[model samples]
Target: MKNIISTIAFLFITINLISQENNQMKLGDKIGEFSALDDQGNVWKSTSAKSDFLVVYFYPAAMTGGCTKQACAYRDDKASFDELGVTVIGISGDEVKNLKYFKDSYQLNFPLLSDNEGTISKIFGVPANKGGEITREIDGENFLLVRSITTPRWTFILNKERKVIYKNAEVNAVEDSKNVKEIIKNYSK
Candidate 1:
């Protein structure tokens, strides 16, 4: 009985590890279709994007220092990205309400997806942890922002074929947009 129990435990562990490994995406991997709610409460579908390239960037949280910088950088580079035939999307565990506030605060022009359940992050193999909350003053009132999970900054670019062409696990928040733009430019050449 003891031996049988041990074998069962080993099998369970192995299966779990294998499943996790399968979810971790790599370059050249074809991304499966996904959809989530955008900050404006609209359903954004992967298959609906008509751009030549798709930029999917995951940030830890909304209204944070590093995340704000990364998002703003992307915002500032919107024109360049549009010119390159790229559609940039930022995903975070924040709720749609929080995402709306963040977008409005920064005047961000791109779509921000709310991945409150971490399902999207898991699909992209981005590391995620427990959710957190922070308070911020937007005028004269303090608003509490909550998240369901926190993901490390990661970026992936998919070509028109829906295959990942670039993956950056260790991303520099301030330089991420610039780096991705250059990468895409060079790739086009």
Candidate 2:
């Protein structure tokens, strides 16, 4: 009986393990090759995206403090990021409704993709379990897993040819803008 219980618990953990940031993406690596649905439920093949620069950021949850600040910072810096030929994108597991609230709350003007199915999360390798802030009761026992990986708080920069020009995967929000700007300054044509 103990083994049966352990097996079930382990299965849960394993399945949920998909969300963490695997970052198959590497510096100077080509743009993503997979397709994902946009906020409007429209299918987008990354190949169809036309931009001199692209900034794809993955975050953990919507409406949360840290996530909100990072997203809003990106939102507030649209012009500068744009002036440098950059397009910003955000991915998260938050449901569509919640995302709408968040976008409205900040009056953000960018595409926010919903990874509720976690396919995009797996592609970007953003940790599925974002610490123990969320909990579930199973068989009257509360199960908790540390996520602490929400959004992985990283950014990717791709040139017109879809080759990565700047990669900032370990930046802190307070200094992320500086780092992104620096990348643009150093690499812009």
Candidate 3:
């Protein structure tokens, strides 16, 4: 009985925390800034950030379909974002090696932040997989997926003031491109 009670309490607390993290809006939410190592072993953080605007996004894994599409979209459109003076930072639980592959494979122009211990992912409210096992599918084939359980997909548009001007909590990498474009167009300094 005591064990059951403790488990129930734990679940309740977990659910509440998930809810709070998942409900974050890109704008107006206080994002705790931290340093993440980039591909070249360079550390990127608020103190050393070099851009008029910043886009911080969290995803489930390194090379999944949705995650890939989203990342590639950003990769392919680096110039436009640069023209708008927006800097991009991507976060995931993948190790630096995997992040290197993802960047090299896609020729990602932006810095990929490593959160191997998932400490940073959790700080951003990115969810963890329910089971310890990470699984996914490619072309309808079963595969072992190693990433957090679920990531709260979001885009934060920080203006020159470092204040979030726009946020997209509901993420669709394909469809959200329009929003991304507009925010940069409007907020680009």
TM-score of each: 0.90, 0.71, 0.76
- Candidate 1 ranges beyond 4 A from true positions: 1-18
**lDDT string, candidate 1, 65-153, tens digits:** 99999999999999999999999999999999899999999999999999989888888888678899999888778999999999889
Supply candidate 1's per-residue lDDT for 127.
Answer: 68
* TM-score preference between candidates 2 and 3, better one: 3
Query: Cα deviation of 42 in candidate 3 (Å)?
Result: 3.7
The full ranking of all candidates by TM-score, starting with the best, is: 1, 3, 2
lDDT (Cα, tens digit) per residue for candidate 3, span 15-111: 9887867754456656556787776667778656677777777766777678889998888778888777778888876666557767876788888
- lDDT of predicted model 3: 0.69
Q: Give the Cα-based TM-score of candidate 2 against the true structure.
A: 0.71
Number of clashes recorded per candidate: 0, 20, 3
Put down candidate 2 lDDT per residue, 16-109, tens digits, no spaces.
Answer: 5543434556666775676655656666566665767777777777666677788888888888887787777787766655556567667888
Give the lowest summed-lDDT range of ten residues in model 1. Answer: 15-24
